[model samples]
Target: MEPREFFIEDRLERFRLKAFCNLGESGLGFFRLEEVLGMAGISVSDLLDLPMNDAPNQGSLELRSAIAKLYPGVSPEQVLVTTGTGEALYLAFHMMVKPKTKVALIWPAFQALYEIPKMLGAEIIPVPQEKAFLASTWKEIDANLYILNHPHNPTGKTFPDAEWENLLSWFREKKKLVLFDEHYRFLPGEGSLGKTGVDPNHSFFGTGSFTKCFGVTGLRVGWLVAEESFVQRARSFKDYLTHTVSPISEKIALGLLENKESFLPGIQTRVRNNIAKFTSLWRKLPHTKDFTVPQGGLVGWLMLEPGISSEAYADRLFEKTGVFVLPGSNFEEEGFLRIGFGETEERMAEGLKRWSECTDLI
Candidate 1:
């Protein structure tokens, strides 16, 4: 069967190298090998002695145990390590979604949330992130599975605490399944940290990676948390894919988790500062309309004048300024653009400045 077109990835692939200032990338700036190793307290020699064999399919005991610490009442057996959050999500959707399966998915999210289920023949019902946690919205739409991207992608809006609790209560009462994509969960926003107290051992599934929040993109390590039965099935399904993570990556991931306390706070601080720089510039740009302030993720939406086409505007901006920002049309929201602030302070400033200078052309 043919796959759905992934607009965001396709656009980036075509224009990434042409742009000198990138405001489209979602992950944080790169970390040097030495800096990363130092943060993990691991030396090059430490990794050399590791055997080049496959790690346990379910992930190493130490790594799984460390991941479990993030969620209250979760056990190592409930976690299945995968290639990345994408793969974890794929496995979850593959197992749970089938022909005509009704899924309530938050809109303008990472495309995989919608595409993968559609590929599996699931009927997707788009729910706006703002209304996702509201009781009124849920009343009109009844679906077997609900997908929520907390500190949501593209927009970064988060569910308020009471609303999250109410939604969880509703899920429990209705016996519905919910899957949370928490890729940005570790990043702190104005008033939210995106942490949830849900127990994944029940009817919930959660997935995340070190890629976004921790700047561990190269490692490609992520995980799925669910009931033990689901974990077992995922692990079995994984055997058809990469089967097991590389011995080296798993060991390094273990090191990062062990020393996260020493580095994560600093990353959070840097991102907040970057966000400030982005907003400061955004406010001064002409022809732009007020947009949503990101509550947590690396990206935020920027609206342009009404009747303007976001994709056309983004194209002109990129051609004139060599600065690339994703159009909201990529996420099925046509009137806005998604700009990422996860670059280093220097790069972010330069990119924003470029956009500011080219306002007349765009």
Candidate 2:
């Protein structure tokens, strides 16, 4: 069957505060906005009173500069803001992938990569994972258009620079467009969409979001980086789609960007602590499930014992534990379950205990 993004809604709701790590959701995690606000001290009175009729210039300008600072060498012109990474992706696919266009997507990726293009009627060639895990090597897809995941979902595998370079060259040689998802770009030293000043004619586009990295899911903000021409086309589509982002949210996000250095380090510490806990727990357990310890992102996948289908196991676990999690079936694979430790420390500890009770000790 032509594959699609794994459906995870049922699993999470069914499970009792599931240990689901499939999607990049940081459960019950909140930005320390209060602390940040105190520092900004930019009171309601501080808002540069301007018309919200169009995208608020008050927030967007500085926000762009902030992004430029984080991702050095990338100009603000390359960064096109949208309501969320989802919107950025929707617009990119809508504008770029036509009915006859050939598309390649990484397996175990977010549901949208392949599903969106297919929905747009593009010819899809999915690079499904080899049996053991969700994210596989580049060899899986013979053709070139690469929909990639650095710190990929479900598996939490961060492709190394060497691999990224190889893939970049391959795409360039084959003259294929790349749609890279840097939703988890907060990972230190994560790969970029292209080499410095890489030509957009060969390298197509990228979508990055603050939601996954900054715990700002409510902000629903993301951006697209490509050649200026590509940005122009996407902007045209976006103008028709949502027009622009919320003026107020853009302001808050702008403030956060202004002080990311102080903020992100703390968030990273929280993520690292939770991951450390999960790593320690997994080491003791004998589920025989193995996966990469993510370098930066917030999710991972576990392969179940042979002959025990991930679907059946995940279903049974949810039935008994009320701890919901995404199964490998959701990623169109078998013998695996996605486990997220991106939740709060309490939830992480409690979820681990529940998981041991349900899986290993039982």
Candidate 3:
């Protein structure tokens, strides 16, 4: 299948070779397999020595039990596990999206949501941040709303609680489908599973990864949550794709989530602390006013000084300062760049310092 080559991924590939601070990383950094081994109450050497193809396929009881602690209502039957949230969403799209269907893509968002649909020849309707639809955009109230209402790559710009209710009501009227990616759902105080498009007929599909909340990237463990039927169909697709997730990875994810109450509190502290440092450095810089602080998520979006294109700024920043941030053009927004505040406070501050110094913006 001819796929639209992901520009961001391509740019990231080249940036890796020359990058220093690597602040553009999306997830909360990574954890070593040995660390995971210890959490699982097992030995690293033994985990490494697992028989090749003999590992269990569906997942282990230890892991499932752990996951159960996270989502008390969500049983193993309800979870469609995969190599990563990427695979989970891939399978969900393949299962739910008809060939040539049109998908509503939220702007300045992850590329995979639209990229995968495009590969299937599905029409991508980008929900332009400039003019987001009213009632028709979501589900409930705006009579002037338009098209099938589904949302992917959430921008954290939803209407308020009452407004959201009206929208949901509007969507229910339209029988819309919302593929919500709560990847950045860093809600205040142990953000709970959101209730955006909770209607079953809404065909709401949610995808998340352990890489974010748990700070475990290499685990390759994430999931797609939907009603039971969707789970079954997606699982069928997953069975044929990568077959199944690693039993070992699932076990580790389970352990972290098993004590999610304990685990997430620490993550919250880290996020708050890092963002504080980033804010301090950002405010100190003369040109920092070009960007706004985000409400949730690890990323901060910034615009360069009026005279500079992000492409040139990013190139010089990396080459001279050994710091890196993905240029906005990669995300299809020129003159803009994305930063992750999930790094060490020192590194986040240092990267900003280097950017200001290298750009000669005292």
Number of the top-ranking candidate, with lDDT as the measure: 1
Error of 1 at 286 (Å): 3.4
Estimate every model's Cα lDDT from 0 to 1: 0.83, 0.63, 0.61
TM for every model, in the order presented, reads 0.95, 0.81, 0.82
Which candidate, 1 or 3, has the higher lDDT?
1
Ranking by TM-score: 1, 3, 2
lDDT, residue 346, candidate 1: 79
RMSD of 1: 1.8
Of the two candidates 2 and 3, the one with more favorable lDDT, higher being better, is: 2
Give a tens-digit lDDT track for model 3, residues 1-362: 86677877787688754665776666565556666555445666655776556233445556544543344356665566677878877887776666768676557667787777778767776666535535445432232212221222222234345755776575665666766565655333235433344333355456666576556777787766667788777767776778867766665676666555655666667766766666666755545446555455566676666656777767767778888777777777776777765666666667777776664522
lDDT of 1 at 206: 92
Clashes of 2: 12
The residue-by-residue lDDT of candidate 2 on 1-362, one tens digit each, is 25343376444544433433222243325456564454344466556674566773222667766655555456677778888877888888877777667776657667777777778777877665443123235545554356766557767665556666666676676676777776766644233222231344556567777666666666777788777777878888787777878876677777767766665676667667877887788754435457657654777777666777777666665565445567788777777767765577776677667767664322
Determine the C-alpha RMSD for candidate 3 after optimal superposition of all C-alphas.
4.1
